[model samples]
Target chain A: MNDKKWIVLGLILFVGLFSFPFWFNVGKAAPAPEVVLTEQAKAAKECVMPTDFMKTEHMQLLDVWRLKVVRDGVSQFVNADGKEFDMSLSNTCLDCHSNKAEFCDRCHNYASVNPYCWDCHIDNPKGDK
Target chain B: MNKFYMSSLLAIFALALIAWVGAPALPWLFGIVLPYLAVAVFVVGFVRRVMGWSRSAVPFAIPTTGGQQRSLPWIKQAKFDNPSSKTGVFVRMALEILTFRSLFRNTRMKMNEGNRLSYHLEIFLWLGALAFHYAFLVTLLRHMRFFLEPVPGAIQMLEAVDGFFRLEILYDSVQFGLPGVYMSGLVLLAAAAYLFLRRLFIANMRYISLPSDYFPLLLIMGIAFTGILMRYFTKVDIAAIKQLAMGLVTFQPSIPAAISPVFYIHLFFVSVLLAYFPFSKLMHLGGIFLSPTRNMLANTREVRHVNPWNYPVKVHTYEAYENEFREKMVEAGLPVDKMPESAPEEMTEEEKE
Candidate 1:
């Protein structure tokens, strides 16, 4: 009842501002993307890496792939699972998952990642998916 | 300030180094969980501390009045200095918080050549303080880049403006004259060093300063130093940092492999800072707002400010006094409200109104 109201209000403000990141994300979990690979990826019926591995490590894998193709002049990749594929991100990976919005943006948008690979390595298709 | 500062300073660096070495062995713990836990502790502890203060009762409207209070309407009240209204209180608090107005008006007393005391504005301390606080704020806002994805436009604009003074020199057709050299970091470092030294160099300040006062300053400096080192000298990979930072942002934390040891050291410093914040004088950031002297309206004369906790006490009325001492009252010349049977009627009818 005294004039200590500001203290409580200020405390609330402090707590609110600090805990913003924790609550700003509450009930905002964008569902995982349903990855639909193109006919090329489906026809091969096999991927450079296992589905589980690709699910988590695709970004780094693509990063390493880009490094190998662009800098080291290495076109072949040998996954930990003993699978060999071209180290080209645009042609090798994107060729099968041509529908960028459906395949890449699915998880990326859910996770709020805007990868800049399309800035240089254009999303040009080998043909229509 | 002498050995305590050195020991605390060394302790912070030792912690940073420990975190650096421990990070490789426990990457997720250092890179992800620690930051989250530190932030959580900071938020909860800050709230608890402030709320604890709030539960205490303030019985008086004792705003530290620097100017005239609102008396007669003809007497012009000093709204900013001795505010009688809520709006005036806000303005005073704003000036105090935004500009460190009291500090700006700081004075130092010195004995003149003629043996007379003289007061002068201690402007350097104020300037250093102003520079340090502002620079720290800018640096904090600038670091929002690593945590936020797609970096908000406002932050980008702020970053550009902060780095606007960078003198661009053509190097191999790429303009790079110290890529965004934030003077804020250097200014903050200098100001902190000056403030820290002031306590040591000046006898009065050294006598007054406790280890508590010096520790937070040294700890903050440690945080700033490690941060600057990571940013400028031993450059950490920005992308890997972004991965780690963004992981925390999205609540999907994964430790990035091969992140720089310097980055871990910097992160450890920051984590320690966060954890230490609520328990330390850093809570002054929030306490300033809650200060009754700064926040309360100086209107004691105009309004009857009641004490909420004031208790009621029994009163001894004249009737009770006469009833309790009727015989004694009749024995003396003292008048009583009621007449006793043995008392004189003339004296009993006394209209003492």
Candidate 2:
């Protein structure tokens, strides 16, 4: 085999880089981040949309809300169930899901999504202990 | 349509349908089992292919030189193009791999009205190839977020940059704006489409293109389409997807119920790609380095390259030949190395009889 040492070295690098994630998380338990719902959220039993819709498309909804409220000056939103609510993340949505660390950060951190929403809006507007 | 690409396209469609329909029923197979098997085959097969290539001796310095080779001290040499040293070869290989330098020199020929030939520099193939490769690489790197438990900051930063050209567009009647749209996936899809089109639309390319060529392009395009479908059109549960990804890497596999069948289709295409890589022309990933014409030094004039396959052969010496033919030579009045006993000048007892 010509250039045996170099070929072996190259192969090692290739395998090491591709299998990085495996070795990085080997022997480590990666439990799915569980969101803790506040009592208010639990009692309400519903959100602006269904649980499944919110699970996949909460970000898109938030974007639509931001455009409507801040840009269009339309603070009132009408949901599918003909339910009307204020289009404010801090005042309306966060009112029920107040536990930002457990609810928002849990999944956000798990998915590594750095939403710019936190740049302006407070994590917890209610400041309940 | 040629039977080659038609069969290839059909095979891809069949594979996709299998995963899209079968994943829910056999989650363990699509989610856990096939991915592991595919990776194993990919790694082992890739190494074996490389080793197989290395076993065959180069036996010659056949670097494809495009510039002046190293020669006279006064003559200026194209160091990178026609490398004579290891360092030069390294730089050349780097440029070749990184930039597709050779492809950039592509030219198109057309016969004019008067039987005259005209050449035009072709750059689209090189451009398409470059875009396809880089976008694919970036997309692959960004996917690491799923496998890693605590997704690294570097990957997050890469994601931010890749999606820097953010646009707010209404896709499938839903306006998406929060995460924006990553450019790598779109670029990959577009570039793949372009490459595939090149083979289909171009007369010469279409004639020469084989099933092997179309298969990978179609497979990758299918992978991209399913991925885009999951990301934008039919949004899958990211958290559940992440959970499944983490499970695979941690060797504690699970199939989350929330995952969409589209993900399975995408995964199926990816798995097929991995398994097919070493056996297909995709081995160019490894072949580029082992290619004798690209990697060898163009210093055949200076360095003596002995063929390793040369062997010793039995030969009759001139002295043995003269000894056997000496009597015949003396009789024929031809020059002889030694006087024969029957020669007129030297008479022997045996010859006297």
Candidate 3:
């Protein structure tokens, strides 16, 4: 048991010592040609977008609507033209972003991002061409 | 000066070195093999800890109640705080776990003009904690897309709902850039940082804070930092990562080419976190069930508590006492069942019988 402990400790120490540079070097070295914008800058840019999209002032209204709908066990959905419509969670979002690979993969690929989400989550909605 | 700070800094330095040196030589082992091992350890350790908790004997129904228990008709009762029945306990536990009801009622004391104590609502901590937990949960749920061949619609829906503000803009056009910016990750990081800082800065909190408390916070922060790095800075192959994750889930493991070394470093920290979770203060996730404050009801005062240690004893009968004292009672002019002269003979006869 003692020997095993020492071995595991040694291995952890070895791994830890070797893995630091990879973490620290991120975003510090030469900027990759594919790099579009830093995460901070991206967030900042989004913060400056139009108020309608940002919804900062209208958050209370949305919150009230959400609380009422959820409390009453009512499902609220609308079509693209704001017409009354019935839709599930997936269809509601996927209706707009149709091509998952083209849209999601393109940016993530350029960004060199590894999203484990696709492992379990369905990227493409069924019955959507 | 503390062991936690010393050890964490040392570990961080070591990992930085390893990441630099081991990049080219053992990318596959670091990137692919280590993550698989971590996930396995996480699942097994989590289950074992939960099982161990379940197996431990409670020996008593000790639900912690903060309100009045149900008693007489005249007695005013606090139903939610002090629940007397099983249903009430269930409701209380549900509220506690789902909404952190107790934390929402937290109070902080401050000294006023004359050093008089004043109580104020401390809702920020509660809100921060709530935000952190929900964000962590959502982020975990969103990651489900990587492990399964066909991701669940529910998870996709969650991602959409989370990124609704971003996705709704391009109704007809296919627009995507680092989808959603993973706002939950940022929120979780901020909350965790705030909690850590609060513990460090507040004199009372700092006095009571232990190395165990700080270590978990550091580990979690490390995981978050690495994750952010992988997403925005040193990009790894998502498709390859998905394949690797799927392979691990399915039990046929394979390391895809072109996976980044930084990804492995992130995975390593996450794995370390998982392995440490069961042994650390993080067990509070399970410890909430055993908490005296949350589990014990305030009914001990009203109920009769018989100590399980009462025993029976042999005793002399009153008739025997009267017979022995009859002669003495006659001599002293007290009433006797038999005459003194007859009593002695009668006693002898009784003895013989």
Candidate 4:
């Protein structure tokens, strides 16, 4: 009985502490700050455009490389850089985007966005290339 | 029939009623107190359950093998299904955890011509399950930025990659309108609902389905529903909610008033899920490690196993019995050894004196 009472009391205290946030800002109603896109952000956004004609060329090059590897029946090591590597289904895309940290992180931090992927995925930004 | 299911149903119904009746007073308890309690319960309960499972004795290597056992070189083997080595087992476990490989191979039986049984490939369940799990994973990954102070670069990269297809025109014009719709959340809910409904509606599934299964499905659905409501309908202050979440993560509690009551409702449901996860079927997350089928190897046939429970017992030897039986055997005209010419015959005590 005593143990139960203590537990209940502890829960009450914890809840009271958590509730401070709701009550603390009762008088304040400041709106969130608007996000301003920088030149780099605009460039990054443009680079990712769905209708960008350059993407077709990029995709075609990838397809040609894939076809060549498949035809040769040889292990495709590295990304056009002639470095030795393992071939697996998991690392298919990593062949090209070897420097992921350099290419990807700049825009994301600017956007103030959070992504849940790092929970389990390992970032192998620097591959054989 | 099962206590777990019955209790779950009762608790859920009771909570639903409480939420309905105490709607006016929910902001105090549901918004604040319940979440704290749930988190406490989740952490403690998960640890306790895992410890208990780890302590339990498993005296046998009872791995469920679906292929040929390790034997002579001449014999054929099932390499992937019944792995013979540690590396193979690790590979199998990896595939199973990451891709639900076993579920993918699931088949359904049906009657064919002449009433013959035939197996049909059932891929819908696998697809739905995969969608649900991956979506859940993605959603979880997206939420990590709220918890950590200096968000990792890798996570940022993933976020950018995920939202790469966003309309540039909209991005330039509005500047912000919920960035991009997190498709994973919607996909997760839809897939989970499909799985739940299939179990409820399908005959075979319904027969095997117990209340425990239904409860988790319902609870998850409820959580998803509340979350969707918060996102699309309520439109709570994201910044304030993040501040509150960050504060919780930091151990310094500050509840922002701008956070809506609907957000509280969503938090309450999430809290309930956390508390229930440890005690409920969701513990399969931990139980997978202890599963004999997944962890053990099938090597029992090659090795001798002594029953640990065997007790010592006195045994009667034949030689001691023979001395007592020798006189009786000679009198009864049974075959006996000549005094010095032949060896004496051995006998058991029950046969002799």
Instruction: Identify the runs in model 1 with alpha carbons over 4 angstroms from their true place.
Output: A1-6, A23-129, B72-76, B167-178, B313-322, B325-353
By DockQ thresholds, what CAPRI class is model 4?
A: incorrect
Itemize residue pairs with steric clashes in candidate 4.
A21-B254, A21-B255, A22-B255, A115-B141, A116-B141, A116-B142, A117-B141
Q: Which residue window of length 10 is worst by lDDT in model 3 chain B? A: B167-176
Model 3 TM: 0.61
- DockQ of the candidate models in sequence: 0.12, 0.73, 0.02, 0.03
Q: What is the C-alpha lDDT profile of model 2 across B39-157, one tens digit per residue?
A: 99999999999988777786776889999999999999999999998999999899989999999999989999999999998999999999999999999999998999799999999
Which ranges in model 2 have alpha carbons more than 4 Å from their true place?
Answer: B113-116, B170-174, B312-353
In the range B77-158, model 4's lDDT, one tens digit per residue, is 6665677776767766777778878888899999999999999999999999899888877766766655443555766666
Task: Please write out the lDDT profile of model 1 over residues B115-184, one tens digit for every residue.
Answer: 9999999998888889889989988877776666555667667767776676433323332333345677
**lDDT, residue A82, model 3:** 59
Question: What are the models' TM-scores?
Answer: 0.72, 0.93, 0.61, 0.61
Q: Give candidate 3 regions above 4 Å deviation.
A: A1-129, B1-3, B16-24, B31-33, B55-62, B74-76, B167-177, B301-353
Looking at model 4, residue A75 earns an lDDT score of: 53
Q: Which scores better on DockQ, 2 or 3?
A: 2
Q: What is the lDDT of candidate 1?
A: 0.74
Candidate 4 chain A: worst 10 consecutive residues by lDDT?
A47-56
Cα error, candidate 3, residue B64 (Å): 3.1
Q: How would you class the docking of model 2?
A: medium
Considering only chain B, report the TM-score of each candidate against the true chain B.
Answer: 0.87, 0.91, 0.77, 0.77
Worst 10 residues of 4 chain B by lDDT: B168-177
Task: Show the colliding residue pairs in model 2.
Answer: none
For model 1 the local lDDT of residue A103 reads: 81
